[model samples]
Target: MTTPVLYLFGSAAPPVADVAGVITDAQHRGFDVCLGLTPTAARWLAPQLTELERLTGHPVRSEYKMPGTPDVWPKADVIALAPATFNTVNSWALGLTHDFVVGVVAEGIGKRIPTVTMPCVNAAYVQHRQFERSVSELRSMGVRVLYGEDGFQPNQPGQGHPSEYPWHLVLEAAVEMHQG
Candidate 1:
């Protein structure tokens, strides 16, 4: 089976735990999962987050510190950035690539690869003018920016599993790419 590279970017926000469930589900579906974490997210999850790397059999990239030399990343089949933070989104839209997570995005951009960014930020930020512009630019560049059908509300009352994330949508898109 061809391994599909799945890059998952996280933030330190409270939604990280809920977002973790989505990433975990993706791994169970057989994608080679990568946990591209920022400093705060790394600190929040600490070592337990290692489960993703071990379970998916993929090395996690958190820090930008070079280990003598930069390691080359294998070609990615799909890149998904969930819970993309305000800072991260703006940085990517502005082409500011420094941290490991942002660097991965920059490389992915250079490769002309398929990318998905799902921002789970405050509703206010989502409504912000600049944020809307960034989303527009990302969409124009062919990046799939998913705001879910309605929105993601953790522990939402009467929420059923099916009503949560539309993972089937992601799978459908993945299948289309493979078929094409």
Candidate 2:
């Protein structure tokens, strides 16, 4: 039997520093991991692309392919958006497909694919009225929004530590969804 495919989406949050670790963990958990990064996140992680590709045996993607081009990655059995930033959450909720990451996620929801998102926003961003509404919108669409006490709690404004971003929780959620 083939291992399940996980399309891991990453946004430009500090926790993205540990994305390599997440990829490694996913592989250990029996997933074929494919990485998709938002533009800023791609730039932030550029130096590690070769290593990341080596680990996953797939190229890291951060932009949409041109029309008529064949997709390189396999279709995902599940999608996990970790270190999902406030901007990405809002953009996705608003159905903005301006970037590759959001575009794929939006399409995934439309396809009713199992999707999970774990935001890495601080307290100040969470306070924004749009943040809560965005989370609600995603949940309504059947996407697992991993926020709150059971998932990710907002850190105090300007007090977030990237190392504490619960990357494992997001991976676990995705794995559970895939297994079930």
Give the best candidate by TM-score. Answer: 2
Q: Compared with the true structure, what per-residue lDDT tens digits does model 1 show for residues 86-165? A: 77877788788867787777677778777876665665566667877887777788777776463343333333243344
The top-ranked prediction according to lDDT is 2
| Candidate 1 segments whose C-alpha is farther than 4 A from its true place | 65-73, 148-180
TM-score of each: 0.77, 0.98
| Root mean square deviation (Cα) for candidate 1 | 4.1
Per-residue error at 118 for model 1, in Å? 0.6
Task: Tell me each candidate's RMSD, in Å, in order.
Answer: 4.1, 0.8
- After superposing candidate 2 on the true structure, give the runs of residues whose Cα lies further than 4 Å from its correct spot: none
